[model samples]
Target: MRRQVLFVGLICVTFLVNAQEEKTIDLDEVTIQASSIIRKKDRQLIFPSKDQVRRSMDGLDLTRRMSLPRLWVDPNTKSISMANGNVQLRINGVLASSLEVAALSPEDIKRVEYHDNPGLRYGEGVDIVLDYITIKRTSGGNLGVDLSHQLNTFWRADYIYGKYNRGRSEFSLSSFANGHRYKEAWQDRTEIFHTPDGTFQRTQEGISGRDYEMYWTTTANYNYTKDDDYFLNAKLNFYYYDYPHNYSSALLRNSESKMTTDLIDNNKSLNTRPSLDLYYFRKLPRKQSLAVNVVGTYSNTDSRHTYREELESIPLTDIYTKVDGKRYYPLVIGIPCAM
Candidate 1:
């Protein structure tokens, strides 16, 4: 019940700007921080972006690790706070992915660097500050696939696949899922310690409820690399959630008969969230990189609470059956109220 409110809603960025700062991914090529770096294989540009950091470390992390220079992100809150402290990140003279210093998987990284001073290619007209991040996809590299499984109350699995090569092509994909059956029983007690004569009524009522859940999320991406060393990526991500519930309650008293009923039936919900990303990547000779990413998202929830009640033979107690040579009955006789 507590998980519904935070289903989805998030964003972070506090700064003045004139045209979005180029993605920090292009920082290595455009800024001076990436000066002390070396590339072993065919490369165009590599930069830093904590985007994956927040993703891999989401509320329920699967199996991914990230390295960042400086950042404060909470999984429960989905909020982030970062500062570069005189360090400016740039990509081809433009701002890139928002991050100060970072580390991530090779597939998600193009290049990396540490700049001591800010440069014109880093920012256009934004208030200059220290610290930045740049990131982009590899153009023609081979993809490495990662998958894992956890067998328990339900089957759970995660996957990651993507590649880049010779700075000319790129692609990536990730997913998480689980299925299982769970059984739980709940009992609640309420007492009104009061009577019509202001004495001790000691009214006690007990309630019980049960629930079940099944969920999963999947995302796919595609990228186009141009000879000019600029990368154009089209990303589509889809995620959803589903859960069902049931409930019942009862009341008892010494002077009156006990009453019981099912309060909920067929109460269920299905939710979905889809997002799109458009970003660019550029690499510089000095080991600096740059990138620009713009993303939009949409989410929807569909739910319903169903209920029902059925009673047979208006005089339920008068009608009885024989048990162990004796007659058993509900034992109730009173005036009915139409109100």
Candidate 2:
């Protein structure tokens, strides 16, 4: 009996050893390599790879490919936003417009400097800054066009950009236009209002008339840069917007004895803005610099609205309003000093 018990104990030990061996695992080593990012105290410098530049269509596309943290890029709107605040885009320390960014060539980009903490030099309310450094171009030119439209809706947008560089100067022109028109819009809603006279309920139904909008902007810019020692830029911009027809008519029924009334509202507006900008920069000794900016702008707006209520095609109430305003700044100058 003792021999039998010892044999059984040995068998159990062998089974346990086999189970432990089956549960054991062997792992392979893994190594992680850093990407093209340089970390600094207050900012980070990023370099785009050859592959990234080759696939990118423009500066905006390259920025999206970089996948910078907390930065959002919308291709449809051609806008960039950051978390908690707005993002400031600059080219070699100079503020850049959307058109300038769109006209940039990925091949000309050298490096990007990102700053999350800005000093007093940037002024107040400056949250983040992205500075794009570009390589010197002896002579070159680029032309591009962007178009977007909805599949089933009457919405369309187009942008055309062209730039030419020679020696130490560059010229660029860009235009953006978009339009929308709604053929048929129907509204069915119930509204309840409490007035001084009494509480009333309104039920509106039927077709809301055609609505249309149009907008366009054009910019012309000239820039001169001589080895970073001297810089000058001049830009002119013109913008126009028109909303000539926004008419809505509906059959409104009131709670008072189920009375029916025809409601119609019409609104239209026109706006125009023209602006000119000039900037100059010079490098001074002892790590100091001189910068000057000048701007002139004018804006005008004209709006008109009409409202009417009719019973059995007879007008019961009619109201109309018109507003016109214009403003202009002949000259505005600013100088910034850095040490």
Candidate 3:
């Protein structure tokens, strides 16, 4: 028995020694980089750093600096767009306008939420949505101005905004304008006619033209808010657009006829629009909320167009048309709440 026990112990010691002789293998180093974007199931949240907020002039400027993926920010229009599509803007779940965006204080922003695919709650045709979550301030104000001009062109965009908050009440006023008034514009196009007869092609070569286009909007806002409770906002907007002159003179040459014609086209349009918006929001228990929005608007418009064509000094075609119209939009109400 002693002999057998000694033999087993020797075998166990040999197995233990082999187990202790296991080798260690070194692995290649891996680097993991963190991104600023936080993706959720249905949305992406972007948190702006202190440096980003400090350098931004206003809410619109902050958004422009974010360089959001697949979204284009246009400073001239104070708008955000995607490829051939529009993105809806909101402030803390409430619909926001350009005036509100201009009046926003960059310091108050907490995070930006982007929804690439909207659910049915947002209604049809609503693909993209941007929601700006903000921290409520009891008192303070903001003033901002944005101006851009092209050195070689006569186009300019101007915006001015002011806001003041006292206690739980806030007031803001903002105005934005974009337009160009110049006589040295250019336009070129190719026209094709497909009929039972042989196809005809006309290519227009423009030398010089005149353009006058302007769009202006101003808004006054009053808001009441209580942190973690409820809020009410009332806004009045006045919008105007004028394109008094858009004249283009070009040489139209027919590829088949081997003929050239002098063509001049002119267009003019004017619009006056006024709108009112009312919004209310209340927070509920169990992380629920209720919101209501109402909007009403009225518009008046005038438009005119004229076309003149001549082979020589004499006119071959002269066409003119004018239209004037007025419209009133009834109150539009929306309620999006969670229980």
Q: Give the whole-model CA lDDT for all candidates, comma-separated.
A: 0.40, 0.78, 0.78
TM-score of each: 0.42, 0.78, 0.79
Q: What would you estimate as the lDDT of candidate 1? A: 0.40
Over 1-339, each residue of candidate 1 has an lDDT whose tens digit, in order, gives 211111132232222111111333544556544432343332222243445434542211211233333534432222233464433433322332221111123323343443333344444443333222224444333333233333333323333333333344444454545443334334444445555665333332434445566666655656566655666766676767776554433333422324443322345677777777666667666666565667677767666655443222222222222222221222222221221
True-vs-predicted CA distance for residue 30, candidate 1, Å? 27
lDDT of 2 by residue, 99-141 (tens): 6676678877888888889766666888888888887665767
Q: What residue pairs are clashing in model 3?
A: none
Whole-model lDDT for model 3 versus the true structure?
0.78
Comparing 1 with 2 on lDDT, the higher-scoring candidate is 2
TM-score-wise, the better of 2 and 3 is: 3
User: In model 2, where do residues sit more than 4 Å from their true spots?
Assistant: 1-35, 82-84, 117-126, 148-154, 186-188, 194-200, 312-317
Candidate 3 residue runs with Cα over 4 Å from true position: 1-39, 148-154, 192-197, 256-259, 283-290, 311-316, 334-336
Off by over 4 Å in 1: 1-152, 155-157, 185-210, 224-231, 244-262, 279-300, 307-339
